[model samples]
Target chain A: MLNEKEKHRYSRHLLLDKVGLQGQEKLKAAKVLVIGAGGLGCPVLLYLTAAGVGTIGIIDFDLVDETNLQRQILFSINDIGKNKALAAKHHLEQQNPYITIKAFAEKLTSKNALELVQQFDVIVDGTDNFSTRYLVNDACVITEKPLVYGSIYKFEGQVSVFNYNNGPSYRCLFPEPPKAGSVPNCSQIGVIGVLPGLIGTQQANETLKIILEIGTVLSGKLLIYDALSGNSTSINIKRSEEQIDKTKAMKPHFASFNYDAFCGIDLINTIDITELKELLKSENIQVVDVREEWEQPRINELNALIAPLDDLDDFVNQIDRNKKVVMVCQRGARSLQAILHLKKEYGFNNLINLEGGLLNWK
Target chain B: MKINVIYFGMIAEAIGKNVETLQINSIQPNTDDLTTFFIQQYPVLKNKSFKIAVNQQMATNNTVINENDEIALLPPFAGG
Candidate 1:
């Protein structure tokens, strides 16, 4: 079914025994939906487009931020402030005129996830949040679509394939989302710019394999790549019957699933920097710095107690339970952990974690 | 029993090292025991969420670990 132009365009693929003209036609017939237009999404979109996937749908509500230039290779300075999905679509169209790219410049909510994902053969998760990730996984499970998952943090990245051939889903690997704000993202802790590129390329490879039915896919394996040490580890994952049953039970009413609530991201024990500044004016309040001593740019204005996270147990008795306690760290991650420990172990309910920590303090 | 443990991502940051060897007093220790031992030794990990992989396989708390087995602690990463 390949035209003369199509044959020449995919000459390299035609030459390969694994991906000959037949496989190229399969690529042309495939439809993939990629979620998020961030780092991992950038590379996945690029490779998928170049590989001549027939129809690609991109869903992202975020605009192109100045910070994304480092790794989001689809955008340039001119694309800043534009909608990410639209910008990526324009760039990808220029990269390959033979393929079709659909851009949805809106958030993929529980209402739209099922409808949108059902149209695509594969769902690619490039999102950077627990809520969206869980939503995507559930939607894929409900729709019976394979998901190509990728995530990065600091110098490490993780890649996996979920809901493929009745294989393990993301929930099978991570049964529950980590406590909100307990894990710092790239914005909080920095990630090496190249890490996502490597992981995203692997995700693209998995997608191709799934489409071509050639090599073994990462269906029940987690690939952990550490950029710092140049080490790669593969961890085998097992399917959980309980998680599969949970997904099936929610399939009938998938529209009502509240992913944010499921991920426990709606924080009740958090105070913004502005509110903390106002609270500082009052008496009987203590601002505790839980960061390590080596952490920089101390907050002298708060007269904080340097309780450092590892040494928190030693300072627990010294903290005043009657007074309002505010825990802080470099970012909000460790502070949230400290607050959880204090509330759970010490029975201190008078504690709050700084929402954005010192990074947001003016 | 001596076991080799590896930590990844934020778990490595909290543990201060990527890999280590520990001597467990029990001849056959379960993942829950190893988790408890690590939490007691590295209190910073008490509140952090991570999954344990025994010999490159996902491990449940009840999974028994043997001597010379390789265990890894993998923390969740939401960054794309």
Candidate 2:
């Protein structure tokens, strides 16, 4: 039974031909959990709150930064440096006072992923990295919860619903994470301010559709959108039968590995500063720093060259084929691309990607 | 064979546009041949890393390219 204020608060929603009284009731009964209160989470929570989801949980370990204000619409300049989940909860509650908003101000780890995910009717992933994406997928599979996933790069974004009614999981679509530092984050690269809002709103729409049982759900399908051309493409994803295991009958457990370590952040497997110093004695390989000119710790003694990523092509043409090129960048992403290009163009297969780049040089 | 060369993500930004086409007239051009063609045309691409997709699927360096196939030059997918 709708209360007097409730009826008026959502009168437009209740009057909609597709979403009537029953739909409103369905929304009121739904419990949704959103992971990450960053760019994607801001709009997702805002929309879900406006639509009157019964309960919403927001989890984030990060604090707000000046850099986040460009796309994180739920936050203001005053909220800078505050905990993201707490700030998001405070703001979202004010937006829709009738709906319940819970804030979990901690990192989402494998230990808590399964238990936390099982508590909600729907899970939305707004995480920005690969390991969390995988963790969310695995946990969703374990809990049989539907996941609305959205991600944005420089100018393109991808949105999908995974683990819905035994649909394909994120792992089924992307079996493995890419090699470390292969691509830069929005922090390293950049994204348009409105890109996340565009993608996040779409994610929120998918969540509502799932809750109210409305329009087509993006199950077993990956939708890729390009902001530049305004083009959208849907790729069909089929479930891999062999990958599905019936081991849920046994004790359910969470993953135990550190995602940062899994993503190659540890420096053990890579060459160290001393090893690099030893290699500098050889004239056969030329170390090219792809970091910007102003970046610190510039090497002056070694057999090295300064070539910013913007000028990599012009410098590539001048290199000698006899000398191997060891590319270096701040985070190794730009250097890897430079190495790949050198190997592809000049047949310099001897190029090596300086793991972790100059930041890990020591 | 004429193949449409599609650029995506950072690759498009580097190329300053989204779509382009390349003509290859061998029985099946090896990945090296396509690589050489691209580098020869746009020397700047020689310093950028990318993966080739034959009809929306990731292809390897040794993958053979057939005529009229839709080839996509995709930068690394950074999205979660």
Candidate 3:
């Protein structure tokens, strides 16, 4: 049944013992949607396209930035400032003309997640943030589609398959998001250039595996990889009945609500370094670092003090009532918490929570 | 009992390796026993967020670990 051109194009794949002509056919028939055309999406798109996947959908609203060139391999210098999904679609179409590539240059809000996901056989989560991750999981759960998920931060990456044939979902693993701003992004901490590539390729492999039904799917299990030391481990997870109940009740409608605030993405109220520098010259602003004693990125300048939040009562007496105060934490949530408490207790009308906290100070 | 312990993330940082063989006194060490062993060996890891995996699978606090089986300590993961 193989044509000359088709056989030649997938010769390497056909040669594999596990993935012969039958497997190749399955791959060709498969329809997959890869969300977020960023770091993880690039490698996922590349491999899926090269593998001759029949239809691949890419969803991303963000344009490529100069900073993204370091890790997002799909974009080149010329591709910078271009919409990521469009750029990835253009390149992937050229890579394999046999496959149908659909590019959706829009953010993956809850309103569109289910509609977009229903068209695909499997959904690959290349998204970088928690809110989108939860949204994708919920959408996949409701649609009964398998989700091939991958994520990267610094030298670490996590891969998992959620809602695979009634298997556990993302909430089964991490029931709730960490109290916001506690975790740092890859942008803030910096990931190894090849880390997302390695992880995304693994995600692509899982996608193919799910399509061809070749090997074991990572359903109900989480795989953690450390690129720095090259160590990998797998953890088995059982479906949490409570989490399933909670997710079942979730009727996600992004059009009705502000997801950034609902999920705490836009929680940062950051003032840039230039602003902080200017504030110091004025002396009207008091910089309060609310990070605990052991937390790093400490500032060693004037007007900055270590007034941790847990012991706010102890520091209440030390407050400078006459000046405007900028509260900071490792990320930002704690600083906001401090500001809320300070304004309530002392009537500190000049209190402002530093956006993005001290982590963004550099 | 000798068990193969697998460490992940910051737990691997605390234990300083991916896998290690540990000999314990009990036949089936409870969660308390395992936590105590790690606390005794690496005190700094007492507060690091983590979960346990038994025999190449994630397990609960009461899940029984056996000899020659793999046990993993995982930290709070922040990926996608």
The prediction achieving the highest DockQ against the true structure is: 1
* Highest TM-score against the true fold, candidate: 1
Against the correct fold, how does model 2 do in TM-score?
0.70
What docking tier does model 2 reach? Answer: acceptable
lDDT agreement with native, every candidate: 0.88, 0.77, 0.78
Give stretches of model 1 more than 4 Å off: A267-362
Q: Give the number of colliding residue pairs in candidate 1.
A: 0
Query: A214-321, model 1: which lDDT tens digit per residue?
Result: 989998999998898899999999889888787876775567555765666544478888888889987669989999887877878889989998889899767766
Chain B TM for prediction 2 = 0.81
User: Pairing residues by index, what is the TM-score of model 3?
Assistant: 0.68
The worst-scoring run of ten residues by lDDT in candidate 1 chain A lies at: A340-349
TM-scores vs. true structure, each candidate: 0.79, 0.70, 0.68
Candidate achieving higher TM-score, 1 or 2: 1
Error in Å for residue A127 of model 1? 0.3
> Residue pairs in steric clash, candidate 3?
A236-B58, A269-A355, A270-A355
DockQ comparison, 1 vs 3, better candidate? 1
In terms of lDDT, the poorest run of 10 residues in model 1 chain B is: B58-67
